[model samples]
Target: MTASQDIISLSNPVLLEKVDKLRDLNIGQHVPLPQLVVVGDQSSGKSSLLESLTGIPFPQDQSLCTRYATQITSRRHNKDSVDVRIIPGPRALEEHRKHVEGFHRQVPSNLEFRKQFVDILKTANERMGIRADVSSGSGTVFSEDVLKIEICGPHEDYLTIIDVPGIFRTTTQGTTKNDIVMVKNLVKRYIKDRRTIILAVLPSNVDIATQEILELAEEFDKSGERTLGVLTKPDLVLEPSAQAAVCDLVQGKKRPLNLGYYLVRNRGPNSGLEGHSELDKIFRKHPWADLPRDRVGIVALKEQLKSLLVAITQREFPALLREIVSQIAECRREFNSLGSPRQDEREQRSFLCQIAGAFQERARAALTADYGADSVFDQDELRLITHVVNITDVFNADFHENAHSLNFEKLGRSEPSEEVEMLSDYDGVRKASSIISDLRTLIKKANVGVLWSKEFVELSEIVTLGNTPMPMPRDNFSEWINGIYLKSRGLDLGTFNANFIATAFAEQSRKWSEITKIYMRRIIVTIHRFIAAALRSVCSEEQVRTQVWEAILQHLVKCYKKAMDQVDVLVEVEHRKKPYTLNRQFAEARSKARGYRATEQLYPKARKDTKQFGETQYVVNLDDVAKVAEGKNNMEQLQEDIHDILHAYYSLAANRFIDNVFQLAVDYCLLHGPSSPLKVFTQDWVINLKAEQLERMVGETKATKKRRSGLAKKIADLENALKILVS
Candidate 1:
């Protein structure tokens, strides 16, 4: 090495060494690291510059250096040593990483260093699955894995420099279009970090405007803050004008950079200039002599890079320390969330029991509506009781608003338009048309006095179940009731038959089946959703989650079927059995309904008999009113009474059924029983399972194990990095 190259201390050795250890710990994969990274276009003289700086001869050929990045780290130590290893990329497979990590070689000083170093790189390439020859085509042409070479000596400068794969625009025999994009992305990944000092390499012969490396550097560091341009092969630009342009760039006369540009003349394999002293002779003549002395040679470039790297490290160290502490806390939380690994059958069983206990605790919280401070309960779908009650409230409102088969007020106003009646017959029964006509006549007279009771008026304001109500016009309902009355009529002549009342009540409630099905489906879906969310929180492994789901599915199906059966029974009793309720609300409803027969329309109005005494006069006579009342017969009054009775009984039975369904079918069977679906997964259930079943139910998957291992390694690395920064 030249005496001028060693003129400056490379860096504060202690600070750079600390950062180097942190980089070696691979915490940079989680966060950015402070270092110098070399980036340029393909064939940009980057390798020759690195060889000049490190005094380690890199392969002069372009094929070997462009495949992967190389990291050269130098440390000041008591003994001289050189060790080489491969740090696998994030995408490397487990077996590939294992094989690559096992590669280690100690370069002996007795042998030639360049040959040994190049041979080691070739071996590392094969280990990384990159083909030796292009035509062989069995492996990749480029990789993200880094080749790490560490040098330690009594007088070595403590520094770290990374050479990233050169960016390429086209593909060759072994490389595809994908390789072009891959190389660019790899370079960008390295230079994008704010802590990385970019050494943008440019060949002096190429047009500066066309070089890709400067464009990228400008893109990432838009302020030109951390980039330093290195112009190589200055002797190749022989023209006076072009040489002045290069001199102008070096002096910041053209495109200015914060830390401007440096010019270096490196010795190629075929170049006559064998050393730095020989190269200095050419710069002493002609146009290059006009440039400043500090920006002209390899030694000056090294000193500038060393000083810049040290400055960046000193400025970013505290921020990096805070970042490490933050990462340690976050990674520790994620690692703990994965829980302890289960290795054997006993451990798997115990793990399953723990999950089950957690499941039961959350499930109990849902069942009782006891949502405490846990964020999991914040989601509406997970709160089982609240969801069930909201749906039940909708069900109750739906039944009250739309359960009855008839709307009496609407039917009374719009009577059937057809008038021909009293002739058709089928199956030895009266035709529905004749009954409709007869019933319409009665409704027109009875509707004047009809008014909705207080209970029915309030039910009108409640929201429906978002479904269209069953259409039963008054004429159709009257026809149906008359048919029932005829069939049930017996020894009761002047009075109405009570048997038809049950039949009318049963017919009005036929919609209970459809409405109940909708309600039950909602409850089942809510319970199933809550179960899935709870299981996901408790168990991290997908296989175990699936097994637990299968176990719960069986119990869930049984519970739903049982609940539906119970619901069907409730419907059956309402349909097949007699209509009966001991509540006093029935009496008030019956009295209100009977008032329809005595409307003000029944009274006769007195008309002017004659224009008396030159003025119009009106008179009210008792005889006229008595005659109007006497026109109606016993049969009409009986039909009106039966109609009123049917309406009163339907209202009474509907409210009773709504309460029973929410309590018995929903609460008792599916949500609260000993065999409830919510209680299917428990510690008792895990204890009862066989060893093989437990193994299948709770065993950790390969992906889970791999993730846990990765997190454990990351946490250890971060903790170590924190210690290095603090100490």
Candidate 2:
């Protein structure tokens, strides 16, 4: 009787169940799964060993020796049963896969199961289009499809073994030269995986060095860690020398393996207790008995394989689980990128409607500054209202800095080499005066190259020059307004002309149009960027995103043009209309200016005194000052009043005009109202689209459909894989 220890199975049910679940899900196609693959040369007892292990009668005829690989799975169950199916290979076409999957059979595990099992194999071979003999060349010599056989019984050991086509050197009547190569390549494909434990079956009668399976195993597993040699048909070795060589090979004295070797006797078709007894009797004789008792016979080999499989499963399970989880995540991402299926007009329109609705919600949220905790609003570019407000603020600063005609603080001051002719209201002692008495002395001592032009330099540059001359001589504010005052003087004898004030105010605010237009352009660009990002987030299809963009782009262009037209009208009003204001500040400013004492001194005949030594002084003719003060225009008071009114009115108008640009041009035309471009994508707009337009916008390609299908299948497989590992 076989020792109890020799028949003990080390199979861990939990680990083997996980492996079986993954295998059934076909997860091995994506990631390598731990397996025990039986590979050997032709007639090397591979079929015999598989039959003994699985308790299934595999065909052993010379013509029917595993034309394609067979996956034999054995499980312990309450009753005896056999289930058979086909697992199509990677290279199988869709049509071929359907046909192969249709081949299924259930055989009763009774006395006649052997015959029924053989018939089932024959039927599977026919379904795969593998001919019984290739002499007539009607069918293929080999196939990538696999025959799956599942055996369940209370006494069966839980295991899975793949039996590939046996290696052959010569071409027979049923096999050709190409067939020989195909068989070797097929066998290599199975054993080459690092996760696979290679069971290299070798006949004891054959020379060990000449076996191709062992050489192939060594090629992939150089360290011999995963390769386990199985010396079969040990009873066939009759000679003492051949038997000694077989014993030496089994003991690892010759061509040593890391996993060592096992010796088993082929009991032909006998299995169960009868096969074990026959195998034990053959191993008891001569040199075979000298071999390790635990490394001989069918029972010991089965238990050893169970132990090795369980050990490798525990070793590689963590990494395999990680790979499975990684694959699941990647597959879901790709599947999502393809979006939901849209095969017909209804589905396509529904998909577009969903995108349009999402876009509208996001646009509203962005424009209203109602940013919830959504990550989409976290990006600065997507904050449309915030971006527009910032742009408005920058425009306000730029307008204040560059739009004014003069710097009001430096209005009454004279330039270098210039003198102000004024009628002084000074008392007995000297007061802080705006007059520079010696013009030529100051010009000579100045460091800058001063160009005393008859008029001012660029108004923008003049405003920037602090305490520096504006390249103009004499009183800059009075001089600037004197020209306009003279031209507009009519019946007003004591007061300055009102028309001149309007002209000055118009010139001061002229740059508003240009600055506002620049701000508008920035807002338009920000809107376009937001539209693009929102579209991409909602829908990934290029065709859909592009078509939707086109629909909205025309509207955006029109909105910008309308906004610019409105701005032009506003600027035109500021330049052409009369300077009139109900603002109390303007009236208060005029009254305040009239109440101040006259600072300007009219020195009609002022001569520089050369005899003053280091102090350059001017000698004033008091008699000529009286004559100049009595002139017609009263230009001194006229200039002072005009300066005050211009400063006050400009401040009031600047604030009003900036608010108008933001409300009428940006909010009404581009951002907020019904005509606004941001309202272009809505559910109503999607519903109103024509059938042809919807089709053009949402049509899907065949390749996209195929890719989506593939990814979906992958995700399903990987999800099943994850569940297997987790459970």
Kindly give the number of clashing pairs for every candidate: 0, 5
Clashing residue pairs in candidate 1 are none
Give the alpha carbon lDDT tens digit for every residue of 1-727 in model 2. 2222221232377678778778767777889889999999888998888877776667667556688888888888888888888988866778998999998888778345676877777788899998876676578878888888887888888888888988989988877899888888898888888899999999989999889888899899999999999988876789999998988988889999998899887656444546567667977777777888899988888999898888888778777877887888888888777766787878878888889888888897888888884787876667778767666655665566555666553323343788643222121113311222232233234211222341123112221223432221123556678778877788876696667777888767766766666666666666666777778777778877888887776666676677778888888888888988998876775554433322234422567677645776667676765554464457765776677778667777877788888898888987887888778888888888888888788877888877887788888888888776765
Single out the weakest 10-residue window by summed lDDT for candidate 2. 454-463
Query: RMSD in angstroms, all models?
Result: 12.3, 11.7
Model 1, span 507-605: residue lDDT tens? 677678877776776676667667878888778767778888877676677777778888899899889887777888778766654333332333236
Which stretches in model 1 have alpha-carbon errors above 4 Å? 1-11, 41-44, 59-66, 107-141, 165-182, 270-275, 332-356, 373-554, 570-664, 681-709
Instruction: Judge candidate 1 against the unseen true structure and give its global Cα lDDT, from 0 to 1.
Output: 0.75
Listed in order, each prediction's TM-score against the native is 0.68, 0.71
lDDT against the true structure, each candidate:
0.75, 0.74
> How many residue pairs of model 1 clash at the backbone?
0
TM-score of 1: 0.68
